[model samples]
Target: MAAFEGAANPSEAIESGYYVHAPGKLLVDNISNRIALRPSSSHLLLGGIGSGKTTQLLVACQQINEIEDIHAIYVDVSRYTDISKITTGVLTAITGLELAKLIKDSQDKNVIESIKLIRNLAHGYTTEYDPYDDFYDDGGQYIAVKGIIPKKTEGYGISLQLVETVSKLAKATFENYGNLVLLFDGLDRLDDAKAFMQVVYSDAKSISSSGIGVVLIGSLTAIYGDYHDTVDKSLDYLCYQPFFDVENDPEAYNFFEEIIQTRSSEDFIEEAAIKALIRFSGGVLRDFITLTQASIEETYLSGEDKVQEQQVLKAVDSIGRNQLLGISDNELKIIKQILKTRIFIPRTDEDLRLLVRRVILEYRYPKLRYAVHPAIKPLIQQILD
Candidate 1:
């Protein structure tokens, strides 16, 4: 469906709307094949925020649906923390109705059939099938998105709910094609990443139980932290795998470098710039792209249109101030305060420990509590003075 993000500046973006999918070879090869969805919980697409998990999932979904005899669906599960909104988005995904089309159908289909496909596909909150339908059997009633009462699927039944919903949609999607695949997008931005993963794993478990097929996209590093105790206790048998494993390859800078060069709307960015980007970002893919994007925007401001190394440095300084300094204002303040006391926290954790050892050796010397980064030390000292 064409997105409703409104008319784009097509003239300027002949190349602007491009996006680069990163961590190239690994994702291009392993991501889609890692899981056996048949007789298994629907596969989870695991990565961190800005890890390009969504892009990978979408591509995978598109690839799967292209296969003969397979059906595919992509649901946006990130927004379904509520009853009404959940009902609307879920309904739309199931029926393939663009929000605009669903609303426009309000007058033509009366409301029910226009939304019947939507309501029928969602978990009716209380095992109740079509609460609105109680009023009329074939009344053709569609719920407005404005006042949706959200019903989140819980661990015990959430798996059943999403899988059942997808299975029904699959039947219709592949009536002619023979297989069904559903893709849920934009998960990391959801309010509770932990809850979403629980829902996904739970749904996957249920699907595995019933032997249905679905694809879940979400973050990996954050997942273990979310339900560690439960994973050890209840869900270990499900056996999930993350998309990227940095531990196996200590020399993973190449992976970071590859992500930096992923395509945007069109033009292939210079390979050298991509390498420069990976280094500039400390090997974080998302950070690398964000820095490049910001720098590219600045280049436009500087009366040029190409991203440059100097502009990138400017982007880093801004990002460092916003992310590092803004988040650690109190810590920075304390660091500055310690400087006034001739105390410094080591730039590295080890250095801080060594300084503490010195305090121990010379009891008369003031005990040190923290250390400031040498790069910022001068400014901090001046601030305190």
Candidate 2:
């Protein structure tokens, strides 16, 4: 049987059959207006795992690139640095590599030489300098170099040096390409949401003032928590990438059906089975796709012509059991309480953790709502009983 596995990342999703238009277009329009009126703009794109935040960032980048007057530089921060242990020094090194790649590819002798000079001055830090011998090829693309910056550096001096280099590159890029926009993704992987906010709060002004627009992806907690106002004030816009509207929207169901058809026969999955999978996913795209994939396997193994209700239930039970195995007793208790009330207000790290782990799902359409993952409801009741 052909399985309906969803995209693992935005790039793959963009080239796949199930790609849909998200709210990122609004962000692109906002940035376009800002660019026409001002020298630079900085903003935030916030969402939970599988909420299509990365897809939104990719959409923004693709739309920005379509503009004749702007050159967009997309950087996946987690690729060059460790989010769990990132610090100012490490951030600088990673940011510098993205800047340096653009500069080197521009082939402007003056900018290239200036970067070399900055690299020499910043050589005292843990960031290494790999010259043309390693990065350049006949194809004329300046391939990026990847390495981690040592956590225990001599001092904070490296941060200053890296910042200076990035500023120079941003200025040069704008001079050559009319305008510049930096789209940063993968910072949400950081363990502490506050650190993600702190980094953006500290650097938003410099990046914007340098004539470089910024679109950063951050943790949902930092976007919706008490510090949300602070985040709102720090950037041009703090936008939330929403989950699917499965509960109240007919269009949502059609979208899921189309996704299944793209990878398999239209009749491969029963209509009742599809609805059950959607309800179980609670509108989280990743969970829905994953459960659908599991159901396909279960049906194929059972020699059924099409997926049935029993096979869908088996898939849901399997996923639910896996999720329950990962949480602590206290976390489970918090989730049980949320199930009892069908309400969740983020007040502590535990609350944030529950949302992050997908033990609790969030919905904004029709009204704000939170509930235990639908697939795990049976397991939760078992515990309570």
lDDT of 1 by residue, 1-385 (tens): 0110113221222234343443335442353453323322255554444444555666666556555555555566544444212322332233333222324324434333424544534434223346466664755445433212245442123323344444443334343445444556654444454555455545444443433355655443233344545433423223222222232333455565444433342333355555455554543334555666776666668886565666666665676554434324555554555656856433543332333222101111122123332223344455456
Give the TM-score of each candidate. Answer: 0.54, 0.83
Kindly report which residue stretches of model 1 are placed more than 4 angstroms away from their true locations once superposed: 1-28, 34-41, 78-174, 191-194, 206-211, 220-222, 229-276, 303-307, 325-385
Best-matching candidate per TM-score: 2
RMSD after CA superposition, every candidate = 11.6, 7.0
Off by over 4 Å in 2: 1-3, 22-39, 89-93, 105-109, 117-160, 224-226
How does residue 45 of candidate 2 score in lDDT? 78
Model 2 lDDT per residue over 120-183, tens place: 4433324434445655454443333323353332323234545666777777866667787788
lDDT of 2 at 108: 74
* Cα error of candidate 2 at position 380, Å: 0.6
